[model samples]
Target: MVPTTITLHNTGNPLSPAANERGWLTNPANPRQASFHIVVDEREAIECIPLSENAWHAGDGSGSKSGNRTSIGVEICESGNYAKTLDNAVKLVAGMLKDRGWGVDRLRRHWDWSKKICPRLMYDDGKWTGWIDFKNRVNAELKGADNVKLDSEKVNVIVNGKKIKDGKLENGVTYVPLRAVGDALGATIGFDNKTKTATLDMKV
Candidate 1:
C-alpha cells in the first residue's frame, strides 16, 4: 500500500495490555478479522501488519479511496499507565511520519474514516479536546525530529586515544560539534556568516 496518511485508533480496553492486543490479533479463535499495522503501549510497540500492505482498519471498506488502502493504522493501547502509552504512541507515530516525510496534517482519526468514535478516548465526549492534544504532542515530536535531536541517542567518540564530547550517532553516521572536536584536536574551526563558509585551521 502506498500509504498517504496515518489513521489513529485507541484500543479502549484498559484491561488489556499491548501484548494482549497483539495476541488477540494473532489468535486463531478471535473471530474478529480487523487488523492494525502497529499496536503501541507504555512499554512496547508491536507491529501486526506490514506498512507496505493494507490492513482492514478504518472500517471504510476495501475501496480505492478508503483509508484502509490509503493509510496506515496505528492502535494505541490504553492499559496501565495511560499517559506513558500516549507518549510512546506519539514517538511511534512521529517516527512513522518522519520516515514518510509527512506532516502532522496527514494524521487522521478513526472518526474521520467511518464516523465512529473509534479512538474513543480521544473523542473527549465529542469535544475532540483530547484528539487535539494528541496531535499536538505528535507534532512536537516531529518538530524535535526536524531539529535532528535523534543524533544524540548513541555512541561515544574518541580521537587520538582522547575522549571527545558531543559525539552523536544518527542514521548510522557519527557527528560531532566541529568547533569542539577541532579544539580537542589542536585545530581552530571558523565559519563566515556572509559566505556561509566553514574553515578549519590546524597548527602542527
Candidate 2:
C-alpha cells in the first residue's frame, strides 16, 4: 500500500523503551520503519547506520515510497540508549544537512509522513526538528573541530644575526625557509648538523 499523509501535530507523547522497541522494530520490514530516519545503537563505541536508501519503515502513510527516492535515513546501535545516540545522530545528520544545504525540517521522522515511529526519538521539541537545528549543530561542530594550521606560518629568516628577509607569504601565511632567503640575499647558507640550525655566511 502507498503510504502518505502522516500527521505530526498533537501526536502521542511516546512510549517506554521496551514498548518502543516492539513497535519500532515490530515488523522489521514494516512500512513505518523509515519514520525515525536515524536509528542509533549505543552499545558499542558508536555505530551509525544510514538509511539513505528506501526503508520499509513508513507505514501506510501519504509519502511511503519506502524513502528510496525521497528521505535519508540513519540508524544507530547503542547501549544505555536514553537519547545517548541523539548527540551522535544529530552530528551525522547535521553533516548531511550542511553538506547538502538541507534544513532540520528536512530531518524528518518516519511518523512525520507515515504512521510509525521508526526512530522513536526527538530533539527537545519541534524547535529542533527541522533544518534549523541541523545547521546550528553543524556550525557549532565546525567551530569546535581542530583547525588545520598551515606549515608556512612558522617560517621566518635571520641572516648575520639580523632579520633581513621575511618568509614568502601566502594566504596570510609564510613559507620561505631560512636557507632559501639567505641564498637569495647572496649569502652562503648551510645546515649545521651539530647545532641543527641554518648558518648563513654573508659578505659583510
Candidate 3:
C-alpha cells in the first residue's frame, strides 16, 4: 500500500499501555476487528502490523480513497504519562515522516477520516488547538532532528521481577532486547526466513 498520509489516533482507553494494545491486536481471541500499524506509549512504540499492510484503524469503510487504505495508522496510548507518551509519539511519527521525505502536511488526525471525535484528548474545547499544538511539536521535531545529538547509557531491563538483560538508554528512552522480552513473557518466537521477520506469539 502506498501511504499518502499518516493517520493518528488515540486508544481512547486511558489505562492501556502500548504493549497491552499490541498484545490485544495480536491475540487471536479478540472479537473486535480494529487494528493499527503501531502503538505508542510513554516508554516505546510497539508495532502490531507491518507498515506495508493496511490497518483497519480509520473509521472510514474500506475503499480505494479511504483513510484505512491510503494512510498508515498510529495509535497513541492515553495512559497516565500523556506528556511522555506524546513525546515518544512525536519522535516515532517525526522519524517516520523524515524517513519517507514527508512533511507535517502529511499528518492527519482520525477526525479527518471520519466524523468520530477520536483522539478526543487533543480537542481543546471543541477546537483544533490541541491538534495544532501536536503538529507544531512534530514540526519542531522534524527541524531538530539534524541538529540533535543522542547520548547512550547502559541500564538494567527488569521484567516480572527479573532482570532479563542489560538495556540501553538514549534520548530519554530505554531500549530492551526483543528476545528477552518474549522469553520473559513465555511467548513462542518464530522467524520468517523469507521476510526476515521475527514474531513473538503466545502459547495458546
Candidate 4:
C-alpha cells in the first residue's frame, strides 16, 4: 500500500549512535521485533526498510487499519547535536512529502497513533506546539518545490497542429503523461521487466 501519512519517532536512547541504532534494527541475530523505514541523524539519514513495506515502528498493534500498515515511520536519532538532528529530520520529512505527493497535513506524531510519547522532544512538557511548528516548516519547504502540483487548471497538449491531450502544470512546469506523448508521436511503447527499461518503437 502507498503510504498516506508520515510518523515521527525518537530513538529514545540518547546515547545510542545512529549507526548502532541502524545495526540493531537490521541485525539478523538481535531478534528485536521493532523496525522503522528510516533513521535520521545530524550527519545523515539511513534507510533500514523499504517504504513499500510497513515497519513495526508505530505503537499500534497488528491491525488492518493501524498506522504501521499505512504510514511511513521515521526515527530521529538523539545523539550528537540536538539541533542538527531536528534539522535533518525536517529535511528528510520535507523530501518524503515531496516524493509521496503529500502535504504537511499528512504528518502525524507517534502519539497520534498510540499512547506512546515518541519523538519525545517534540511532545515533552506539553510542547505539542512544536509539532505545529514543524508542520509549518515543512510547508515552507514544499512551496515552489520540485514535487507535482495538484491543480485543477488543465494544460492542453498539441502535436502537429492537433490537440492531443491535456497536461498539468507543476511548479510552473508543464508535465504531459508519458503514454499520451507516445500515442501522439505514433510510437509503440514497450517495457522490459528484467532491465526495467522503456522502449519506444517509432517504426510501429
Cα lDDT of all candidates, in order?
Answer: 0.82, 0.43, 0.83, 0.77
- TM for candidate 2 is 0.37
| TM agreement with the true structure for every prediction | 0.70, 0.37, 0.70, 0.67
lDDT of 3 by residue, 1-204 (tens): 789999989999899999899899768899999899999999989888889888998989999999999999999999977877987898899999999999999999999999788778777456554576577668878999423334778888888888776778888888775656777888754544346566777778
Off-target runs (Cα >4 Å) in candidate 3 are 145-204
lDDT of 4 by residue, 1-204 (tens): 568899998899888767889899757788779889998888989888899998988878878788999889999888898767876788889989998788988998899999688778766355454565566657767885334355635789997676765777766788764545666787655544346555556753
TM-score of 4: 0.67
Model 3, global lDDT: 0.83
Q: Which stretches of candidate 2 lie over 4 Å from their true place?
A: 1-38, 43-52, 60-68, 76-78, 81-83, 115-119, 123-204
- Please report how far candidate 2 places residue 52 from its true position, in Å: 6.1
TM-score of model 3 (CA atoms) = 0.70
lDDT of 1 by residue, 149-185 (tens): 6335656877778876646677778866565567578
| Superior by TM-score: candidate 2 or candidate 3 | 3
- lDDT of each residue in 19-51, candidate 2, tens digit only: 244355556666653343334333322212233
List the candidate numbers ranked by lDDT, top first.
3, 1, 4, 2
- RMSD from true fold, candidate 2: 20.2
Error of 1 at 50 (Å): 0.7
